[model samples]
Target: MRSLIVSCNVTVDGFMAGLGNDLASLDFIVPDSEQENALAARFREVADTIVFGRQTFLDMEAYWTKVDSDMAAWINATPKVVLSTDSGADVSIWNNTTLAAGDGAERVRRLKASEGGGLVMFGGVQTIRSMIAADLVDEYWLKISPVAVGQGSSMFADLPERRSLTLRGAKGYPSGMLDVTYAK
Candidate 1:
């Protein structure tokens, strides 16, 4: 079975997005070293599919489509599955992207049962929360930033109950960003 990984950047206070849903704060926290680039490459290498919520998919498609980078190329080339309820939204702007609406957990379970490489989920707090509530996330790769955004969206909010995690590994960069991996 394929693993579903939650990969995201979070603040020291455990918030994913800053106040006003601003993501500029994260620009300062992203590691710029060659090692960090290599690590990102490895991450993309392992996941054959990229999963996103409806809003995230649209946002990413709008921004990444114009960016020029190795990661952008990888993201564009890899298959994308957007979990959404809005059937009227158009997702044809990006190549290799598909929409899956209905039971989120069941759809993810079916994807896990399929023959493919690992899957990575990145973006939109509510979607991640739903996945966590459904107990469908297999692994978490959180890049904890140094600064704390006093108020913002949290990745662990509204969880049905406490969930224990085993620390698989952690890597800290010179920028004070820690890449931590946890397994359920």
Candidate 2:
């Protein structure tokens, strides 16, 4: 079975988006070069499906589809499974996106067990946290951004249960980014 990976960027202070992330300064949807583009492409090659939280879906809707980069658009358009209560309109670029609710862990487990590639979480901090608390995340791709939001949104779920991830590897980017991969 393929692994469920929680991938996102965070700051040095352990905050994913400061505290609230209302400003959305932490998101790096804008990759400026071919190398970074290639790196993301490589990651996508291992990932067959991309799971998204409602808020993350909205955020993606606000930015990615409007983008001009074919590579970035292709990545965003990749199979996105959204877990949200909002009945928002779907973007044309996100054609394969589906809405899923209730028993997220079980659904994700089913997704992993079925025939496909690895599953990667796209922003959904709550979803990621819930899955993590449920011991669902098999891998993590944390791209640490240099900026700090001071008080924005958090990446991990505020669950009563906690889990640990084993650091696999980390590489620094020219834009002061550190991509860290972990496994549990």
Winner by TM-score: 1
C-alpha TM-scores of all predictions: 0.89, 0.81
Counted clashes in each candidate structure: 0, 10
Model 2 agreement with the true structure over 93-146: per-residue lDDT tens digits: 466888776577777888888899888887666677778777778888776777
Pairs of residues clashing in candidate 1 = none
lDDT of each: 0.82, 0.70
Give the Å shift of residue 127 in candidate 1: 0.4
TM-score of 2: 0.81
Model 1: CA > 4 A from native: 19-36
- 1-184 in candidate 1: lDDT tens per residue? 9999998888888899766556565563665455456556966767899899888898889887897777678788999998887766677889998888877677888898999999999867888888888888999988888887678878887876788999999988877888899999
* C-alpha lDDT (0 to 100) for residue 103 of candidate 2: 70
Off by over 4 Å in 2: 20-35, 85-93, 149-153, 156-163
Residue 81 shift from truth in candidate 2, angstroms: 0.9
